[model samples]
Target: MSDLPLDQVRTLLAVVDEQSFDRAAAVLHVTPSAVSQRVKALEQRLGRVLILRTKPVRLTGSGQVVVRFARQLTRLEEDTRAELGLVGAAEPVTLPIAVNADSLATWFLPALAAVPAVGSAPAVAFDLHSEDQDHTATLLREGLVMAAVTSAPNPVQGCTSARLGRMRYRAVASPAFVARWLTDRPLPEALPAAPAVLFGRKDELQDRFLRGLTRRGATGVRHFVPSSESFVDAVAAGLGWGMVPELQHRADELVDLAPDHPADVPLYWQQWKLDSPALATVAAAVVAAAATALRQ
Candidate 1:
Protein backbone atom coordinates (compact mmCIF):
# COMPACT_ATOMS: atom_id res chain seq x y z
CA MET A 1 0.00 0.00 0.00
CA SER A 2 2.80 2.40 0.92
CA ASP A 3 4.52 1.46 -2.33
CA LEU A 4 1.43 2.52 -4.37
CA PRO A 5 1.74 6.04 -5.77
CA LEU A 6 -1.18 8.48 -6.11
CA ASP A 7 -0.10 9.19 -9.71
CA GLN A 8 -0.42 5.49 -10.53
CA VAL A 9 -3.85 5.32 -8.88
CA ARG A 10 -5.04 8.37 -10.82
CA THR A 11 -3.59 6.98 -14.06
CA LEU A 12 -5.51 3.74 -13.56
CA LEU A 13 -8.73 5.70 -13.08
CA ALA A 14 -8.07 7.78 -16.21
CA VAL A 15 -7.65 4.59 -18.26
CA VAL A 16 -10.84 3.12 -16.83
CA ASP A 17 -12.85 6.24 -17.56
CA GLU A 18 -11.38 6.88 -21.00
CA GLN A 19 -11.49 3.11 -21.75
CA SER A 20 -8.17 3.20 -23.58
CA PHE A 21 -4.55 3.45 -22.51
CA ASP A 22 -3.84 5.58 -25.56
CA ARG A 23 -6.62 8.03 -24.77
CA ALA A 24 -5.60 8.21 -21.13
CA ALA A 25 -2.04 8.84 -22.20
CA ALA A 26 -3.18 11.62 -24.49
CA VAL A 27 -5.13 13.24 -21.67
CA LEU A 28 -2.14 13.01 -19.36
CA HIS A 29 0.20 14.17 -22.15
CA VAL A 30 2.35 11.08 -21.71
CA THR A 31 3.29 8.11 -23.90
CA PRO A 32 0.99 5.05 -23.88
CA SER A 33 3.90 2.97 -22.59
CA ALA A 34 4.17 5.24 -19.54
CA VAL A 35 0.45 4.86 -18.82
CA SER A 36 0.66 1.08 -19.23
CA GLN A 37 3.71 0.89 -16.99
CA ARG A 38 2.01 2.97 -14.28
CA VAL A 39 -1.03 0.71 -14.30
CA LYS A 40 1.10 -2.40 -14.27
CA ALA A 41 3.12 -1.07 -11.37
CA LEU A 42 -0.06 -0.20 -9.46
CA GLU A 43 -1.43 -3.71 -10.04
CA GLN A 44 1.78 -5.26 -8.74
CA ARG A 45 1.73 -3.08 -5.67
CA LEU A 46 -1.93 -3.74 -4.90
CA GLY A 47 -1.53 -7.42 -5.77
CA ARG A 48 -4.90 -7.26 -7.58
CA VAL A 49 -5.71 -6.86 -11.24
CA LEU A 50 -7.50 -3.55 -11.81
CA ILE A 51 -8.97 -3.62 -15.29
CA LEU A 52 -10.09 -5.99 -18.00
CA ARG A 53 -8.22 -5.27 -21.25
CA THR A 54 -11.19 -5.30 -23.58
CA LYS A 55 -12.73 -2.89 -26.02
CA PRO A 56 -14.35 -0.10 -23.99
CA VAL A 57 -12.45 -1.68 -21.14
CA ARG A 58 -14.28 -2.72 -18.00
CA LEU A 59 -13.10 -2.34 -14.41
CA THR A 60 -12.71 -5.35 -12.17
CA GLY A 61 -14.51 -5.47 -8.81
CA SER A 62 -11.37 -4.28 -7.06
CA GLY A 63 -10.89 -1.72 -9.82
CA GLN A 64 -14.23 -0.13 -8.99
CA VAL A 65 -13.11 0.35 -5.40
CA VAL A 66 -9.97 2.13 -6.55
CA VAL A 67 -11.90 4.22 -9.04
CA ARG A 68 -14.27 5.31 -6.30
CA PHE A 69 -11.32 6.38 -4.17
CA ALA A 70 -9.75 8.23 -7.07
CA ARG A 71 -12.95 10.21 -7.63
CA GLN A 72 -13.21 11.03 -3.94
CA LEU A 73 -9.62 12.17 -3.91
CA THR A 74 -10.23 14.46 -6.86
CA ARG A 75 -13.31 15.92 -5.21
CA LEU A 76 -11.48 16.55 -1.97
CA GLU A 77 -8.63 18.29 -3.78
CA GLU A 78 -11.09 20.58 -5.57
CA ASP A 79 -12.93 21.36 -2.35
CA THR A 80 -9.71 22.18 -0.55
CA ARG A 81 -8.65 24.58 -3.29
CA ALA A 82 -12.02 26.28 -3.24
CA GLU A 83 -11.92 26.64 0.54
CA LEU A 84 -8.38 27.99 0.57
CA GLY A 85 -9.14 30.31 -2.36
CA LEU A 86 -6.12 28.79 -4.03
CA VAL A 87 -7.97 28.56 -7.32
CA GLY A 88 -8.03 32.05 -8.74
CA ALA A 89 -11.36 33.19 -10.17
CA ALA A 90 -13.80 30.64 -8.78
CA GLU A 91 -13.79 27.95 -11.42
CA PRO A 92 -17.04 26.63 -12.74
CA VAL A 93 -17.95 23.39 -11.03
CA THR A 94 -18.30 20.63 -13.55
CA LEU A 95 -21.05 18.30 -12.39
CA PRO A 96 -21.04 14.88 -14.01
CA ILE A 97 -24.48 13.30 -13.89
CA ALA A 98 -26.28 10.32 -15.37
CA VAL A 99 -29.69 10.89 -16.93
CA ASN A 100 -32.09 9.09 -19.25
CA ALA A 101 -32.48 10.07 -22.90
CA ASP A 102 -36.14 11.03 -22.52
CA SER A 103 -35.39 13.52 -19.75
CA LEU A 104 -32.36 14.84 -21.62
CA ALA A 105 -34.53 15.70 -24.61
CA THR A 106 -37.31 17.14 -22.49
CA TRP A 107 -36.67 19.01 -19.22
CA PHE A 108 -33.09 18.32 -18.09
CA LEU A 109 -31.29 20.98 -20.12
CA PRO A 110 -33.57 23.80 -19.08
CA ALA A 111 -33.18 22.77 -15.47
CA LEU A 112 -29.40 22.91 -15.74
CA ALA A 113 -29.52 26.31 -17.36
CA ALA A 114 -31.58 27.60 -14.47
CA VAL A 115 -28.80 27.14 -11.92
CA PRO A 116 -27.74 30.62 -10.79
CA ALA A 117 -24.17 31.56 -11.60
CA VAL A 118 -22.24 32.48 -8.51
CA GLY A 119 -19.44 35.07 -8.27
CA SER A 120 -16.42 33.83 -10.16
CA ALA A 121 -17.98 30.36 -9.92
CA PRO A 122 -17.86 29.15 -13.49
CA ALA A 123 -21.16 28.34 -15.16
CA VAL A 124 -22.14 24.73 -14.47
CA ALA A 125 -21.02 22.38 -17.19
CA PHE A 126 -22.89 19.11 -17.18
CA ASP A 127 -21.25 15.79 -18.02
CA LEU A 128 -24.31 13.74 -18.85
CA HIS A 129 -24.28 9.97 -19.27
CA SER A 130 -27.43 9.11 -21.20
CA GLU A 131 -28.93 5.76 -20.38
CA ASP A 132 -32.31 4.27 -19.46
CA GLN A 133 -33.94 5.66 -16.33
CA ASP A 134 -34.02 2.21 -14.72
CA HIS A 135 -30.29 1.80 -15.27
CA THR A 136 -28.96 5.29 -14.54
CA ALA A 137 -28.37 4.45 -10.91
CA THR A 138 -25.81 1.86 -11.94
CA LEU A 139 -23.54 4.69 -13.11
CA LEU A 140 -23.75 6.19 -9.65
CA ARG A 141 -22.84 2.85 -8.01
CA GLU A 142 -19.80 2.62 -10.25
CA GLY A 143 -18.72 6.18 -9.29
CA LEU A 144 -19.00 7.24 -12.91
CA VAL A 145 -21.01 10.34 -12.04
CA MET A 146 -21.67 12.53 -9.05
CA ALA A 147 -25.44 12.58 -9.59
CA ALA A 148 -28.17 10.82 -11.52
CA VAL A 149 -31.84 11.03 -12.45
CA THR A 150 -33.00 7.46 -12.15
CA SER A 151 -36.12 5.35 -11.73
CA ALA A 152 -34.77 3.73 -8.58
CA PRO A 153 -36.14 5.25 -5.37
CA ASN A 154 -33.54 3.65 -3.14
CA PRO A 155 -30.36 5.68 -3.24
CA VAL A 156 -26.92 4.33 -4.11
CA GLN A 157 -24.39 4.14 -1.26
CA GLY A 158 -23.38 7.61 0.00
CA CYS A 159 -26.07 9.25 -2.07
CA THR A 160 -29.39 10.99 -1.36
CA SER A 161 -32.46 10.88 -3.57
CA ALA A 162 -35.61 12.92 -4.12
CA ARG A 163 -38.46 12.44 -6.54
CA LEU A 164 -38.13 14.66 -9.58
CA GLY A 165 -41.37 13.85 -11.39
CA ARG A 166 -42.95 11.33 -13.72
CA MET A 167 -42.48 11.35 -17.48
CA ARG A 168 -45.60 10.19 -19.30
CA TYR A 169 -45.25 8.25 -22.54
CA ARG A 170 -47.89 7.31 -25.08
CA ALA A 171 -47.86 4.66 -27.76
CA VAL A 172 -48.03 6.71 -30.92
CA ALA A 173 -47.78 6.41 -34.68
CA SER A 174 -48.09 8.59 -37.71
CA PRO A 175 -51.63 8.98 -39.02
CA ALA A 176 -50.72 7.17 -42.24
CA PHE A 177 -49.09 4.27 -40.46
CA VAL A 178 -52.03 3.84 -38.09
CA ALA A 179 -54.56 3.93 -40.90
CA ARG A 180 -52.57 1.43 -42.97
CA TRP A 181 -51.52 -0.95 -40.19
CA LEU A 182 -53.88 -0.57 -37.24
CA THR A 183 -57.19 0.01 -39.05
CA ASP A 184 -59.23 0.01 -35.82
CA ARG A 185 -58.09 -3.43 -34.68
CA PRO A 186 -57.43 -3.90 -30.95
CA LEU A 187 -53.94 -2.51 -30.26
CA PRO A 188 -52.49 -5.77 -28.92
CA GLU A 189 -53.50 -7.56 -32.12
CA ALA A 190 -52.44 -4.70 -34.39
CA LEU A 191 -49.26 -3.71 -32.55
CA PRO A 192 -47.64 -7.08 -33.14
CA ALA A 193 -48.50 -6.80 -36.80
CA ALA A 194 -47.30 -3.24 -37.34
CA PRO A 195 -43.60 -2.34 -37.58
CA ALA A 196 -42.32 -0.88 -34.29
CA VAL A 197 -39.38 1.25 -33.15
CA LEU A 198 -37.72 0.48 -29.85
CA PHE A 199 -35.27 2.59 -27.88
CA GLY A 200 -33.09 -0.47 -27.40
CA ARG A 201 -33.31 -4.10 -26.41
CA LYS A 202 -33.49 -3.15 -22.73
CA ASP A 203 -36.48 -0.92 -23.39
CA GLU A 204 -39.46 -2.87 -22.13
CA LEU A 205 -41.59 0.25 -21.58
CA GLN A 206 -43.45 -0.04 -24.84
CA ASP A 207 -43.91 -3.78 -24.49
CA ARG A 208 -45.06 -3.40 -20.89
CA PHE A 209 -47.55 -0.72 -21.90
CA LEU A 210 -48.89 -2.92 -24.68
CA ARG A 211 -49.20 -5.88 -22.33
CA GLY A 212 -51.32 -3.86 -19.92
CA LEU A 213 -53.55 -2.60 -22.70
CA THR A 214 -53.93 -5.84 -24.71
CA ARG A 215 -52.72 -8.53 -22.29
CA ARG A 216 -49.90 -9.48 -24.67
CA GLY A 217 -46.26 -8.53 -25.25
CA ALA A 218 -44.72 -6.59 -28.14
CA THR A 219 -44.06 -7.98 -31.63
CA GLY A 220 -40.90 -9.59 -32.95
CA VAL A 221 -39.97 -6.99 -35.57
CA ARG A 222 -38.49 -3.82 -34.02
CA HIS A 223 -36.11 -1.19 -35.39
CA PHE A 224 -33.67 -0.31 -32.63
CA VAL A 225 -32.93 3.45 -32.61
CA PRO A 226 -31.23 3.94 -29.18
CA SER A 227 -31.77 7.70 -29.15
CA SER A 228 -34.90 9.34 -27.81
CA GLU A 229 -35.11 11.97 -30.54
CA SER A 230 -34.49 9.48 -33.36
CA PHE A 231 -36.97 7.00 -31.95
CA VAL A 232 -39.69 9.67 -32.10
CA ASP A 233 -38.61 10.63 -35.60
CA ALA A 234 -38.67 7.01 -36.73
CA VAL A 235 -42.30 6.79 -35.66
CA ALA A 236 -43.05 10.11 -37.35
CA ALA A 237 -41.36 9.00 -40.56
CA GLY A 238 -43.68 5.97 -40.71
CA LEU A 239 -40.75 3.64 -40.13
CA GLY A 240 -42.36 2.26 -36.96
CA TRP A 241 -44.64 3.20 -34.10
CA GLY A 242 -43.20 3.65 -30.60
CA MET A 243 -43.72 5.10 -27.15
CA VAL A 244 -42.98 8.84 -27.34
CA PRO A 245 -42.38 10.98 -24.32
CA GLU A 246 -45.38 13.26 -23.75
CA LEU A 247 -43.17 16.31 -23.37
CA GLN A 248 -41.66 15.81 -26.83
CA HIS A 249 -45.01 14.79 -28.28
CA ARG A 250 -46.73 18.02 -27.21
CA ALA A 251 -45.32 20.03 -30.11
CA ASP A 252 -45.90 17.33 -32.69
CA GLU A 253 -49.17 16.22 -34.32
CA LEU A 254 -48.49 12.49 -33.93
CA VAL A 255 -51.52 10.26 -33.50
CA ASP A 256 -51.86 8.73 -30.10
CA LEU A 257 -52.82 5.06 -30.41
CA ALA A 258 -54.22 4.68 -26.90
CA PRO A 259 -55.01 8.05 -25.34
CA ASP A 260 -56.31 6.55 -22.13
CA HIS A 261 -53.36 4.28 -21.43
CA PRO A 262 -50.10 6.27 -21.29
CA ALA A 263 -47.15 4.85 -19.44
CA ASP A 264 -45.91 6.99 -16.54
CA VAL A 265 -42.29 6.46 -15.48
CA PRO A 266 -41.33 8.17 -12.24
CA LEU A 267 -37.92 9.85 -12.14
CA TYR A 268 -35.74 10.79 -9.20
CA TRP A 269 -32.57 12.81 -8.66
CA GLN A 270 -29.83 11.03 -6.74
CA GLN A 271 -26.55 12.70 -5.77
CA TRP A 272 -23.65 12.15 -3.42
CA LYS A 273 -24.37 13.23 0.15
CA LEU A 274 -21.40 15.61 0.09
CA ASP A 275 -22.14 19.20 1.11
CA SER A 276 -20.33 20.86 -1.77
CA PRO A 277 -21.94 24.19 -2.64
CA ALA A 278 -21.73 23.48 -6.35
CA LEU A 279 -23.59 20.16 -6.12
CA ALA A 280 -26.26 21.69 -3.90
CA THR A 281 -26.98 24.53 -6.29
CA VAL A 282 -27.28 22.21 -9.28
CA ALA A 283 -29.57 19.82 -7.42
CA ALA A 284 -31.91 22.63 -6.42
CA ALA A 285 -32.11 23.89 -9.99
CA VAL A 286 -32.78 20.42 -11.39
CA VAL A 287 -35.51 19.73 -8.82
CA ALA A 288 -37.16 23.07 -9.49
CA ALA A 289 -37.21 22.54 -13.23
CA ALA A 290 -38.47 18.98 -12.94
CA ALA A 291 -41.41 20.11 -10.81
CA THR A 292 -42.68 22.28 -13.64
CA ALA A 293 -41.92 20.01 -16.60
CA LEU A 294 -42.69 16.47 -15.45
CA ARG A 295 -46.03 15.13 -14.29
CA GLN A 296 -46.23 14.64 -10.54
Candidate 2:
Protein backbone atom coordinates (compact mmCIF):
# COMPACT_ATOMS: atom_id res chain seq x y z
CA MET A 1 0.00 0.00 0.00
CA SER A 2 1.03 3.64 -0.49
CA ASP A 3 2.14 5.69 2.53
CA LEU A 4 -0.78 5.87 4.98
CA PRO A 5 -2.34 9.35 5.18
CA LEU A 6 -1.35 10.97 8.50
CA ASP A 7 -4.81 12.49 9.07
CA GLN A 8 -6.67 9.21 8.55
CA VAL A 9 -4.13 7.19 10.60
CA ARG A 10 -4.34 9.68 13.49
CA THR A 11 -8.14 9.60 13.36
CA LEU A 12 -8.06 5.79 13.61
CA LEU A 13 -5.74 6.07 16.62
CA ALA A 14 -8.18 8.48 18.26
CA VAL A 15 -11.00 5.99 17.79
CA VAL A 16 -8.89 3.20 19.30
CA ASP A 17 -7.92 5.35 22.26
CA GLU A 18 -11.41 6.76 22.87
CA GLN A 19 -13.03 3.34 22.20
CA SER A 20 -15.77 4.99 20.08
CA PHE A 21 -16.12 7.09 16.91
CA ASP A 22 -18.17 9.82 18.65
CA ARG A 23 -15.58 10.25 21.42
CA ALA A 24 -12.81 10.30 18.85
CA ALA A 25 -14.65 13.02 16.90
CA ALA A 26 -15.03 15.10 20.11
CA VAL A 27 -11.31 14.75 20.83
CA LEU A 28 -10.33 15.62 17.26
CA HIS A 29 -12.97 18.43 17.00
CA VAL A 30 -14.55 16.79 13.94
CA THR A 31 -17.93 15.25 13.15
CA PRO A 32 -18.42 11.56 14.04
CA SER A 33 -19.26 10.90 10.37
CA ALA A 34 -15.96 12.48 9.36
CA VAL A 35 -14.09 10.24 11.80
CA SER A 36 -15.87 7.17 10.40
CA GLN A 37 -15.15 8.19 6.84
CA ARG A 38 -11.44 8.70 7.48
CA VAL A 39 -11.15 5.29 9.14
CA LYS A 40 -13.10 3.67 6.30
CA ALA A 41 -10.89 5.35 3.70
CA LEU A 42 -7.77 4.12 5.45
CA GLU A 43 -9.14 0.56 5.61
CA GLN A 44 -10.15 0.64 1.97
CA ARG A 45 -6.70 1.82 0.94
CA LEU A 46 -5.03 -0.99 2.91
CA GLY A 47 -7.60 -3.54 1.62
CA ARG A 48 -8.12 -4.72 5.19
CA VAL A 49 -10.92 -4.65 7.75
CA LEU A 50 -9.24 -2.64 10.50
CA ILE A 51 -11.88 -2.55 13.23
CA LEU A 52 -14.40 -5.11 14.54
CA ARG A 53 -17.01 -2.44 15.47
CA THR A 54 -17.47 -3.99 18.88
CA LYS A 55 -18.92 -1.99 21.79
CA PRO A 56 -15.43 -0.83 22.75
CA VAL A 57 -14.15 -1.17 19.15
CA ARG A 58 -11.63 -3.99 18.98
CA LEU A 59 -8.80 -3.69 16.47
CA THR A 60 -7.88 -6.30 13.90
CA GLY A 61 -4.25 -7.39 13.36
CA SER A 62 -4.02 -4.89 10.49
CA GLY A 63 -5.45 -2.19 12.75
CA GLN A 64 -2.77 -2.83 15.38
CA VAL A 65 -0.04 -2.32 12.76
CA VAL A 66 -1.58 0.97 11.64
CA VAL A 67 -2.04 2.20 15.22
CA ARG A 68 1.58 1.41 16.06
CA PHE A 69 2.70 3.39 13.04
CA ALA A 70 0.47 6.29 14.10
CA ARG A 71 1.94 6.36 17.60
CA GLN A 72 5.50 6.27 16.25
CA LEU A 73 4.69 9.09 13.87
CA THR A 74 3.33 11.16 16.77
CA ARG A 75 6.44 10.46 18.84
CA LEU A 76 8.72 11.50 15.99
CA GLU A 77 6.68 14.65 15.34
CA GLU A 78 6.86 15.68 19.01
CA ASP A 79 10.59 15.07 19.14
CA THR A 80 11.11 17.10 15.99
CA ARG A 81 8.95 19.96 17.31
CA ALA A 82 10.78 19.99 20.65
CA GLU A 83 14.17 20.08 18.92
CA LEU A 84 13.00 22.99 16.70
CA GLY A 85 11.66 24.95 19.72
CA LEU A 86 8.10 24.76 18.36
CA VAL A 87 6.74 23.00 21.45
CA GLY A 88 5.07 24.97 24.26
CA ALA A 89 7.22 25.58 27.35
CA ALA A 90 4.49 24.18 29.63
CA GLU A 91 4.27 20.83 27.87
CA PRO A 92 6.71 18.10 28.89
CA VAL A 93 6.94 14.96 26.78
CA THR A 94 4.78 12.17 28.14
CA LEU A 95 6.30 8.68 27.80
CA PRO A 96 4.02 5.74 28.34
CA ILE A 97 5.59 2.47 29.62
CA ALA A 98 4.44 -0.94 30.78
CA VAL A 99 5.96 -2.43 33.95
CA ASN A 100 5.31 -5.33 36.25
CA ALA A 101 3.89 -4.68 39.72
CA ASP A 102 6.93 -6.09 41.56
CA SER A 103 9.39 -3.84 39.72
CA LEU A 104 7.03 -0.83 40.04
CA ALA A 105 6.73 -1.40 43.79
CA THR A 106 10.50 -1.67 44.16
CA TRP A 107 12.90 -0.12 41.61
CA PHE A 108 10.92 1.28 38.64
CA LEU A 109 9.70 4.67 39.98
CA PRO A 110 13.14 5.52 41.35
CA ALA A 111 14.62 4.88 37.91
CA LEU A 112 12.09 7.21 36.24
CA ALA A 113 12.81 9.91 38.82
CA ALA A 114 16.51 9.64 38.09
CA VAL A 115 16.10 10.28 34.36
CA PRO A 116 17.77 13.58 33.47
CA ALA A 117 15.74 16.32 31.79
CA VAL A 118 15.99 16.73 28.02
CA GLY A 119 15.97 20.51 28.57
CA SER A 120 14.00 22.47 31.21
CA ALA A 121 11.06 20.16 31.81
CA PRO A 122 11.57 17.40 34.41
CA ALA A 123 12.81 14.44 32.33
CA VAL A 124 9.40 13.55 30.86
CA ALA A 125 5.94 13.12 32.36
CA PHE A 126 5.29 9.41 32.86
CA ASP A 127 2.24 7.29 32.05
CA LEU A 128 2.74 3.86 33.62
CA HIS A 129 0.63 0.73 33.04
CA SER A 130 1.41 -2.11 35.42
CA GLU A 131 0.78 -5.74 34.53
CA ASP A 132 2.51 -9.08 35.08
CA GLN A 133 6.05 -9.30 33.72
CA ASP A 134 4.84 -12.12 31.50
CA HIS A 135 2.08 -9.97 29.99
CA THR A 136 3.50 -6.42 29.83
CA ALA A 137 4.74 -7.07 26.29
CA THR A 138 1.10 -7.39 25.20
CA LEU A 139 0.71 -3.65 25.78
CA LEU A 140 3.81 -2.98 23.69
CA ARG A 141 2.44 -5.24 20.93
CA GLU A 142 -0.91 -3.41 21.01
CA GLY A 143 0.69 0.05 20.62
CA LEU A 144 -0.41 0.93 24.14
CA VAL A 145 3.06 1.74 25.49
CA MET A 146 6.44 2.74 24.11
CA ALA A 147 8.52 0.60 26.46
CA ALA A 148 7.95 -2.36 28.76
CA VAL A 149 9.64 -4.34 31.52
CA THR A 150 8.75 -7.78 30.32
CA SER A 151 9.85 -11.37 30.90
CA ALA A 152 10.14 -12.11 27.20
CA PRO A 153 13.62 -11.73 25.80
CA ASN A 154 12.40 -11.63 22.20
CA PRO A 155 11.86 -8.24 20.62
CA VAL A 156 8.32 -7.24 19.56
CA GLN A 157 8.49 -6.28 15.82
CA GLY A 158 10.16 -2.84 15.80
CA CYS A 159 11.38 -2.94 19.41
CA THR A 160 14.82 -3.61 20.89
CA SER A 161 15.21 -6.01 23.81
CA ALA A 162 17.81 -5.77 26.56
CA ARG A 163 18.44 -7.96 29.55
CA LEU A 164 17.63 -6.20 32.86
CA GLY A 165 18.35 -9.10 35.23
CA ARG A 166 16.08 -11.16 37.42
CA MET A 167 13.63 -10.57 40.25
CA ARG A 168 14.05 -13.49 42.63
CA TYR A 169 11.07 -14.77 44.58
CA ARG A 170 11.27 -17.00 47.63
CA ALA A 171 8.43 -19.08 48.97
CA VAL A 172 7.46 -17.63 52.32
CA ALA A 173 4.80 -17.77 55.02
CA SER A 174 4.02 -16.27 58.43
CA PRO A 175 5.08 -18.14 61.55
CA ALA A 176 1.47 -18.65 62.53
CA PHE A 177 0.59 -20.15 59.16
CA VAL A 178 3.47 -22.59 59.37
CA ALA A 179 2.62 -23.55 62.91
CA ARG A 180 -1.02 -24.24 62.10
CA TRP A 181 -0.62 -25.96 58.72
CA LEU A 182 2.92 -27.31 58.42
CA THR A 183 4.26 -27.98 61.90
CA ASP A 184 4.39 -31.77 61.96
CA ARG A 185 3.39 -32.82 58.46
CA PRO A 186 5.83 -33.17 55.61
CA LEU A 187 5.84 -30.06 53.37
CA PRO A 188 4.87 -32.19 50.38
CA GLU A 189 1.81 -33.41 52.30
CA ALA A 190 0.73 -30.19 54.07
CA LEU A 191 1.45 -27.64 51.35
CA PRO A 192 -0.97 -29.08 48.83
CA ALA A 193 -3.83 -28.76 51.34
CA ALA A 194 -2.71 -25.50 53.04
CA PRO A 195 -4.11 -22.16 52.02
CA ALA A 196 -1.95 -20.18 49.60
CA VAL A 197 -1.64 -16.58 48.50
CA LEU A 198 -1.37 -15.75 44.80
CA PHE A 199 -0.90 -12.44 43.04
CA GLY A 200 -3.56 -13.20 40.43
CA ARG A 201 -5.15 -16.04 38.52
CA LYS A 202 -2.23 -15.86 36.10
CA ASP A 203 0.33 -16.04 38.93
CA GLU A 204 2.15 -19.35 38.80
CA LEU A 205 5.03 -18.76 41.21
CA GLN A 206 3.40 -20.42 44.25
CA ASP A 207 1.89 -23.19 42.18
CA ARG A 208 5.15 -23.72 40.30
CA PHE A 209 6.91 -24.10 43.63
CA LEU A 210 4.30 -26.59 44.82
CA ARG A 211 4.64 -28.60 41.61
CA GLY A 212 8.37 -29.00 42.18
CA LEU A 213 7.76 -30.66 45.53
CA THR A 214 4.39 -32.39 45.28
CA ARG A 215 4.06 -32.97 41.52
CA ARG A 216 0.63 -31.34 41.72
CA GLY A 217 -1.09 -27.99 41.95
CA ALA A 218 -2.22 -26.33 45.20
CA THR A 219 -5.61 -27.83 45.97
CA GLY A 220 -6.40 -25.70 49.01
CA VAL A 221 -8.05 -22.29 49.43
CA ARG A 222 -6.47 -19.59 47.24
CA HIS A 223 -6.39 -15.92 48.15
CA PHE A 224 -5.73 -13.50 45.33
CA VAL A 225 -3.93 -10.26 46.21
CA PRO A 226 -3.05 -8.52 42.95
CA SER A 227 -0.76 -5.74 44.15
CA SER A 228 2.87 -6.63 44.87
CA GLU A 229 3.07 -4.89 48.26
CA SER A 230 -0.37 -6.06 49.30
CA PHE A 231 0.48 -9.63 48.27
CA VAL A 232 3.38 -9.55 50.69
CA ASP A 233 1.15 -7.96 53.35
CA ALA A 234 -1.45 -10.67 52.84
CA VAL A 235 1.16 -13.36 53.40
CA ALA A 236 2.58 -11.56 56.45
CA ALA A 237 -0.91 -11.25 57.89
CA GLY A 238 -1.22 -15.05 57.71
CA LEU A 239 -3.45 -15.05 54.65
CA GLY A 240 -1.35 -17.89 53.18
CA TRP A 241 2.07 -18.87 51.98
CA GLY A 242 3.28 -17.06 48.85
CA MET A 243 6.24 -16.27 46.67
CA VAL A 244 7.60 -12.87 47.74
CA PRO A 245 10.13 -10.94 45.74
CA GLU A 246 13.57 -11.08 47.31
CA LEU A 247 13.69 -7.29 47.40
CA GLN A 248 10.39 -7.04 49.29
CA HIS A 249 10.77 -10.08 51.53
CA ARG A 250 11.10 -9.26 55.22
CA ALA A 251 13.33 -11.49 57.31
CA ASP A 252 11.67 -10.75 60.64
CA GLU A 253 8.02 -11.17 59.70
CA LEU A 254 8.11 -13.88 57.02
CA VAL A 255 10.19 -17.04 56.99
CA ASP A 256 11.30 -18.70 53.79
CA LEU A 257 9.43 -21.93 53.21
CA ALA A 258 12.07 -23.31 50.85
CA PRO A 259 15.39 -21.63 50.36
CA ASP A 260 16.44 -23.99 47.62
CA HIS A 261 13.49 -23.42 45.32
CA PRO A 262 13.51 -19.68 44.68
CA ALA A 263 11.70 -18.56 41.55
CA ASP A 264 13.97 -16.27 39.56
CA VAL A 265 11.96 -14.39 36.96
CA PRO A 266 14.38 -12.71 34.62
CA LEU A 267 13.18 -9.34 33.36
CA TYR A 268 14.01 -7.59 30.11
CA TRP A 269 13.59 -4.05 28.80
CA GLN A 270 11.79 -3.70 25.47
CA GLN A 271 11.22 -0.47 23.59
CA TRP A 272 10.67 0.78 20.07
CA LYS A 273 13.94 1.35 18.25
CA LEU A 274 13.37 5.09 18.16
CA ASP A 275 16.01 7.83 18.21
CA SER A 276 14.02 10.12 20.54
CA PRO A 277 16.17 11.62 23.30
CA ALA A 278 13.47 11.31 25.97
CA LEU A 279 13.05 7.57 25.37
CA ALA A 280 16.82 6.99 25.24
CA THR A 281 17.26 8.84 28.56
CA VAL A 282 14.58 6.78 30.30
CA ALA A 283 16.00 3.53 28.90
CA ALA A 284 19.46 4.37 30.24
CA ALA A 285 18.13 5.19 33.70
CA VAL A 286 16.08 1.98 33.83
CA VAL A 287 19.04 -0.19 32.78
CA ALA A 288 21.37 1.47 35.29
CA ALA A 289 18.86 1.12 38.14
CA ALA A 290 18.12 -2.49 37.24
CA ALA A 291 21.83 -3.27 37.48
CA THR A 292 21.81 -2.15 41.11
CA ALA A 293 18.33 -3.29 42.21
CA LEU A 294 17.97 -6.59 40.37
CA ARG A 295 20.08 -9.73 40.56
CA GLN A 296 22.72 -9.93 37.82
In model 2, the runs with Cα more than 4 Å from the true position are 117-122
Candidate 2, residues 204-294, lDDT tens digits: the string is: 7787788887898888999999999899999999999999999999999998988887889999999999988888888988999999999
Top candidate (lDDT): 2
Cα-lDDT of candidate 2: 0.90
How does residue 13 of candidate 2 score in lDDT?
Answer: 89
- Candidate 1 wrongly placed segments (more than 4 Å): 1-4, 88-91, 118-122, 250-252
Pairs that collide in candidate 2 are none
Residue 91 CA error for candidate 2 (Å)? 1.4
Per-residue lDDT of model 1, residues 63-132, tens digit only: 8778877877766677667677765554755678999999998899888877765333435567889999
Query: What are the C-alpha RMSDs, in order, of all predicted structures?
Result: 2.3, 1.9
